[model samples]
Target: MTTAGGRPPRRLRADARDNRDQLLAAARAEFTEQGTHASLNKIAQRAGVGAGTLYRHFPTLAALLAALIGDDVDALCATGRDLMTHPDPDEALAVWLHAVAVHATAMRGLVATQMAALRDRRTAGALAACHDAIRAAGVALLDRAHHHGSAPAHVDIADLLTLVNAAAWASEQAPDDAALLARLLALITAGLRA
Candidate 1:
């Protein structure tokens, strides 16, 4: 493959397309079963491709790892944007938090290099874009709720939405993540109440 501007080289040929998809499937399964040590050779074999072919598609282990997690991250962020079209901001926020929890848990298993890239991205401009979008949605809904006397005057919409994601991350680390999240929502809404 060739590249410029961080895109995968030109359009993949049919054979290359099959190889790439196969590699992704193999890698996902291997990572799930064997954690980060899922060998490249094993993945290549599972995908019915040679190690050289895997390396050709992904020059390094980090490249492959980044590709896997990066695709998912892009999708998750897109979902955050799409949630704006939902009529209910609070419900949208809840769903976004849940999606983040799931994606975070899955990405946590990525190789160290890939994880660092993901971490760095959150500290960059992407974080601000995501945060602002969420806050805007929350403020709109919360303001309406306040007009109806269902939201507290002093509640900080920005801070509350931020806290929700932080709590969601913590919930992701727990064994009973679903139960933990249910409790978290109860506690948060209790505090955020009108």
Candidate 2:
């Protein structure tokens, strides 16, 4: 089966596959609980695998995070596909932007990792593919909204994404104040409307 980015799955032996899967599961838990700074050794221990095995599978924290979040990006693309069919273009764009914000802030420090991966040449291909997929999704939504004349002609997809990213970053800082985030997003959405 192909992975999230349509890359062919690595042909791993049964034991190796098991190790990789365990490592991913453990890493997800550890990262979620401790942020991106979580210890790799603890992750390896949690997975019941040796440090060597973890290193063999994922040489760097960025690689592990990229693998883990690729699935989320794919799901975001699926959300965009579904939003395309919604009857109201403006509402669809608004909802999709909200989804993007949620995805960005789902894990602490994910936005930073994503930004880093976008800049780092070595890991850029996979992460850029995911980023581009999300941008394409946003572009589709923006086009629909523009065609419907609900969104301002001056609005650009990249600008919209940047706005959402900023809101997501704010949400990360004050996670308990979800109402504030919603209000801020609503204000931004309102500004986009014609």
Candidate 3:
């Protein structure tokens, strides 16, 4: 944002910052309950703001999701980086995959949203960056596993993530099964073994 003179705008005013924070908090809750297609008007209502306020802050659903998940993405990437130094490449990859599954499951319908955003040119920037970061992190761990002869050489990051996303979706469908996510991840990791 810029001032009328075209210089960079100052930090958000206190009230504006509070509104943004409230919207994000409400959005997180709504998304958890109703998935990515949750009503924007409902999110605004939950945040005690008008729909226009939400639009002003986040022009698109992808932008809102990017802001919402940015922290988790950063943490996931950081975990992957830290795991790079672990002595057991196979174990590291498995652990990271588990983490990814948990993240995907926690976000409800995130996999679909991410895939849609990646395919849409209008959503090319923020959401694409999030997807790219996740891909990079997973690829690093996957490459290490392949080099150690634990993962199949033909399994690329896209395939792995798609499989993981399916597992996440299954986990969502069987929410009563507490062990479903872990079990699915185990099967996936085992299948990766050559």
Error (Å) of candidate 3 at residue 182 is: 1.1
Candidate 1 similarity to native, TM-score: 0.58
lDDT per residue, candidate 3, 2-31, as tens digits? Answer: 878999987888999999999999999998
Candidate 2 global CA lDDT score: 0.83
Q: List the lowest-lDDT window of 10 residues for candidate 1.
A: 107-116
- Tens digit of per-residue lDDT, candidate 2, span 1-194: 89999999879899999999999999888877877568999999999999999999998766777787889888989999999999999999999998888887756766445654575557656567777889999999999999984898789997888888888778778868868668879988999873
For TM-score, the strongest prediction is 3
> TM-score of every model?
0.58, 0.85, 0.91
Instruction: Write down the lDDT that model 1 would get.
Output: 0.64
lDDT of each: 0.64, 0.83, 0.86
| CA RMSD per model (angstroms) | 6.1, 3.2, 2.8
Deviation (Å) of 14 in candidate 3: 0.9
Instruction: Give the clashing residue pairs of candidate 3, or none.
Output: none
Residue 54 shift from truth in candidate 3, angstroms: 0.5
Which candidate would rank higher by lDDT, 1 or 2?
A: 2
Q: Report how far residue 116 has shifted in candidate 1, in Å.
A: 5.2
